[model samples]
Target: MLNIADVLHRWCRAARPFALATVVDVTGSTPLPIGTSVAVDEDGNAVGSISGGCVEGAVYELCRQVLRDGGAPQRAWFGYSDDDAFAVGLTCGGELDVLVQRIDPIRHPHLTFAFAEVADGRPVGVAQVVDGPEDVVGAMLSIVDDRVHGNAGSGPSSRAVADQAHALLRSGRTARVAIGGQADDCPQSLTVLVHVHAARPRLLIFGAVDFAASLSQVGHFLGYRVTVCDARPVFATAVPYADEVVVDWPHRYLEHTEVDDRTAMCVLTHDAKFDIPLLRLALDLPVGYVGAMGSRRTHQERLRLLTEAGLTQDRLMRLRSPIGLDLGARTPEETAVSITAEIIAHTNLGTGLPLSSTSGPIHRPAVREGAVMK
Candidate 1:
């Protein structure tokens, strides 16, 4: 799976076989998201996780069974059991449907290519036949930039599935797609699990200060490609946590770089000279998050300057000046937590409130319907 692509690539390069158990579907409050996977090598060594700590032992045994069965794929269901406390299930009362399948270069050449694509930071979608006809079950195809490698089934069905997989890949979502017997030359209905491995989103931190360093670490932990950019070379040289460090004017660097809706830009440089031009560009861009660090008075002054720079009120509303939630944070680490929390909340449509006070489902629905496995 893409979650452990690096490890899988190593095993694959060595011609080692492994069984991978991936979370394909979920109902209710699950601990892990869809596409989360755990892989077990031929020697029973495991990597990655699904469900944090709960239900791992059961999944591990399932992986071992798949490996021993000569790569036969299996489906497993885990849910909370009130009737039997000792049952192997999730304690959080959520139901998980996992698909355990074996992978090797011989039978699954597409997977080896998919793993390599993921390792190289390329966007790819792997579509596997989770449930279908006998011969087609466990068949897979990898789609990269509209080009599909390998086969899911027959010619017509594979093309149909690849078309749908391409759409999901563009959206950067993992989902289960159902194809009925409507297509030409395809009579059997099939369920395809399209696992999207989009390239890591950018977390552009525009100041190499201490807070930026701490935030860069958090960004990496969140699976982002972090870059620390500042005009001052002295401050930018030693940001150890960032994936890339750029010593250039923040606004200039941002203008020449690529960004998308998933990119998050943080303006930690509170000085007017740096904040004005950089924010004027950042807020206008269609980035996911644009937060600036400053005090109330500083925020007011920055807003006044931006307003004079001809930024519309709607554009100004997109800026999260005086960034981060009200966490009463003092240390840089705590502040980083607060800022990343705000970014997640904004992206996920979460209310920044205590879960204990909320009475509804803890996990919100996917931003796009059917974008996530549920």
Candidate 2:
């Protein structure tokens, strides 16, 4: 959804008729995770991709047919076909279940607002009816806080659906739920898909050096809301590499900024003058990662100074000094990769070992929950 927000915003506003096909469920390995979508216009132009590029041609045709025939909600499964001649299947050996629905803005008043919400990076969710009475098949509910827009059904059924959708929105996870009387009450229910449009995690880089630029670019590509903070106005002025370039003391900037469990802070200034105070506050915060770039001697010095400033061993332990995985990176770009790799590995709890050296599964197990059929 994040990847296709721009395109959705465009088509939804053009008032052009289109059909959206979403990956509601997946089995085994998949190139794109669930909740990913592709919208096909009346002319067969596509906005996003659900299966990387493997079966897009076939999916495009299916979407075109739906638009032409004005069909009911269609469920299409693409899998590994034993016969090589089969038209649409994952050659990579996985299975995907897609639910395609047509949304007419002329009929559904909230249709434009839903796409605009995602396009503007707002906190919003959509509860789409995939199965039930044919009339409710394409029904949508907008999730904002505890309230919902649009209709799911009449009386108790609508309230039940809205409550379940709000639960999923708060959790910021996608799920398929069947709602009838009360939330999660019975099998005599309507199947709905809830999608949460959460913002990407933040990566705050506290430097404006060559390495910082490279790291900023890599962080941006890694789907981070990257910001570069430096005390020197001259250094901060030219940082087109980050989402935001702030001219302020690293500690001051961090003190005023809001950080959450998903935020990662990197101290690349290397100088103790800037590093000491910043690390003092960063290590004590609830951020997911706090790493500093310096030599072994510098790291030891930093630890001694931080300890003298009343930082406990527990707080110091949170710091990832001499940052990045042991990739022997020398160039700025390579160092950026190494740093981002370490960040990813830390977040995923990965060992950071080469696949050839490790026997564990290359991809982590999907903690998928929701959108289950009874």
Candidate 3:
């Protein structure tokens, strides 16, 4: 996958005309989530994709027009499931809102900065309220990487919105927020979507085993910033982990590293000495899912060791020891699948039921601000 930031940088540096299509919103069972982007040059060649080959042709045609017009911003709506009056729609029966904008780094300094931050591997958000097709004109809610911009408000209201947005950026969420309405009068009823495009999901593999190698390959396939950290330099070498290897003390490694709600940490070390200390350290970080591999007996003994180490009930409850789901996985490949499945399940908060068993919409709700409403 071509990093969207790199695409923007090339377009800017070459001074070539290209249209950028961003999936600003998705109403129903969309193939990709909001904030997905694609850059199409004047030619049909494109980098990145927003949908599952559903509306690319249409968006490409629109890009041609955008390029010809010096890359003017255009708005195109695709609704496969909804009864929208749009000539080009999604084939998978879903709704998608594509924001096709022309890139001019000179005109938009913030956008250029956003591209730089994203290319630098820091998760960021770009929030804006659109009033028209050409509207770069709203409360310019800019967040470079994870930092918030503009006035979020005052007292509880400001802090609340700002905190929520930072949290969402950490989780890589893109959705609208209805802000302003606390005991004071601010900008009430404004539609502001926190455009989080840069934050990369983390893949922390704790072991230096052969299974870890396969897991690293799959983790990169899913676009996670993979990090295979192990104490043994002999095992966790550049050959095994390639570009994604970290040779450090497992427990101490986490102390210097940052892990947020979008982060996933897996304990493949299997040894109690390595697993216990690292798992305990991971519990303190705001990581979303913590997976530890071992047998049932190992988990029991690990828990006892944790208790003896002065770990409290609340902290112990945060671990997903024995890791992965109960997929009856026996082989390394099957075990990898089980581990990945558990990560996905935890990411989506899945109930482990078939889609047919659920009556509600299969899509995740567009993340509205990050912090709790209450």
Candidate 4:
């Protein structure tokens, strides 16, 4: 888990040239996501992992050649196929498509800036090489301060791809795109990897109750930047949250904080006075998940209040009141599990039905067998 700053610092100090490999796209039970990257030094040192050790060895060899010869970038596809299997295929019966590139770090000052912004908790993006020269293969496009920095080569086509990459950055998606080509062109032939570096999930707990504490802990475990915001100064102190506590009015905090599709706001306040305004703010934003804790009657009351406040049925439908899924959870810990499970299910668009009832794919197809490319 090398921080972006540390990655940049190490890259800056390296005197020799090296190639970087990134998992710009994965399919069918693959090990990594679109932005997963690994930096390979000339000596065969690897910083990050793209496929949980599945494809690193093969990618390292590709990187070594890129370092030796500044060649055009190439896309490498690996999958577990009993018939047409490549040497780099996943052993766990998954598929991964990796883009590998040799980058001239000296020429790309903006790459440093992009990683720095990520390290400092600012929103930036990396343009992963989806289609490009082997030397600059799978290398990400570095976007900082609303401008594209690394294009491998600057052209109108490159700029057009960069614009799309920037848009993807705003949406917090990491994937490849085909652009600026005729309709007859192959869909997968287009070259661009748009990888956005977004802020980690933010968990804003409105209440300082014990349930809120357990939820915050769970949120932290799930890689969220947990912030326990409460009006109670004593309860919202650094003891519970340590480095991530916020002592403020929940409504005011929601007003000032940036809530995007990557954000998850939980209204555990369970009090109409404190919860209403905050919930209203969340409903107005494009936040991914909004959860409110209460019983069935409590939710009905809150709905009445929200309707009185002119909240529409469409917006009200977005609220997951009574919080988590129905696991008959009674204790706070069980309730926390239920709530987090609901959040994960919502995030992944999971059906909540037993897997035993399902007959098809286990994981998302986008992660396996090049389905996303189609």
Best candidate, lDDT-wise? 1
Q: State the weakest 10-residue window (summed lDDT) of model 4.
A: 365-374
Candidate 1 per-residue lDDT, tens place, 1-374, comes to 68898898888888899988988888998887777899999899999999888889999998998888874689899988878778787888788889898887777776777889899989999988888887787788999767899988888888878887899898777888898598575667889888888878889999888898899999999889999999998888867668899999999998999887888889998989999999999888878889999999999999999999999998999888799999999999999999999888888877899999887667554453211111
**TM-score computed on alpha carbons, candidate 1:** 0.86
2 versus 3: better TM-score goes to? 2
Error of 2 at 151 (Å): 2.3
* Candidate-wise lDDT, in order: 0.86, 0.79, 0.69, 0.70
RMSD of 4: 5.1
lDDT, candidate 2, equals 0.79
Please report how far candidate 1 places residue 269 from its true position, in Å: 1.8
Mind giving the per-residue lDDT tens digits that candidate 3 earns over 220-329? Answer: 87777788889999998863433478889899888898776777888988898898888777776677778888889989999898888878888788788788888888
Error of 2 at 335 (Å): 1.5
| lDDT, candidate 4, at 276 | 86
Candidate 3 achieves a global lDDT of 0.69
Global CA lDDT computed for model 4: 0.70
Best model number under TM-score: 1
Show the lowest summed lDDT stretch of 10 residues, model 2. 365-374
lDDT of 2 at 48: 89
lDDT of 3 at 12: 62
Superior by lDDT: candidate 2 or candidate 4: 2
Better of 1 and 4 by lDDT: 1
Displacement of residue 149 (Cα, Å) in model 3 is 11
